[model samples]
Target: MSAIRSATVSDLEPLSQLLDDYRRFYAQPSDPAAARAFLAQRLGAADSRLLVHAGQAGALSGFVQLYPVLSTVSLAPRWLLNDLYVHPEARGRGIGRALMQAAATLAREHGVPRLTLSTQTHNKAAQALYESLGWQRNDAFHGYTLTLD
Candidate 1:
């Protein structure tokens, strides 16, 4: 299994490529420049935590991006695992699992009470991976999103 570590600014170029691929997987248009800019802003602002797995030749094979969230009811910090992606060629090599484990470790290190993530209902592969890692499906609450654009 490849070692998972925190992403640095030096990883921007390859990380952006991975981010673009991730967006494309979700049916988004390919826009490398936009992906780079978005990741740049996140890294610069220190608003999100990015964990990456390096593949052969030091290329990033997978990544997980977590955003901090405050739970009012719990009065504690939590993480919203907004993005997790493994290169198609790198799948099944345990990179995704490593990334998720690393994310959980990081969250625990920061005293976060919990970590949360959502995947499309049709993404059975991802759902299985997450469940295997002990992530439970939230049956108690429904998630609703308001898109204003």
Candidate 2:
């Protein structure tokens, strides 16, 4: 069967709750309030792209967030895939994969070259899924970040 459609602001609450659980699964702090706030911002942003999977019982199963960006040198539009989460209770239902496929489809429709995301080194499960999806491992460099303050 075909996957569902891209999500809109109306899905913010359900999407946020699912995100909280996804984070918690990775040992992150469980904070639904913070999750809601973050999701709300993405919902309100014009450049944000969300794809969701709704279960047969009408519950949200998964979601992926894509942010619009531009290449610094080439000046071409691109998409930064920020978050991908499948609810624990709804795992093995192909929600995550479907959402990812939907995200890629959207990016392609907009003429974007690729979809990019990251997982921690220890998150082998996620890495497996990404690899299974044919994502390449960028071994040429390491990821780094600096706190803004």
The candidate that achieves the highest lDDT relative to the unseen native structure: 1
Among these predictions, the greatest TM-score belongs to 1
lDDT by residue (tens digit), candidate 1, 67-90: 999999999999999999999999
**Root-mean-square deviation of Cα positions for candidate 2 versus the true structure, in angstroms:** 2.0
Clashing residue pairs, backbone N/CA/C < 3 A, model 2: none
Worst 10 residues of 1 by lDDT: 1-10
Residue clash pairs of candidate 1 = none
Give the C-alpha miss distance for residue 110 in model 2, angstroms: 0.8
Model 2 spans with C-alpha error above 4 angstroms: 1-3
What shift in Å separates residue 37 of candidate 1 from its native position after superposition?
Answer: 0.3
lDDT value for model 1: 0.94
Relative to the true structure, candidate 1 reaches a TM of 0.97
Q: State the lDDT at 11 in candidate 2.
A: 80
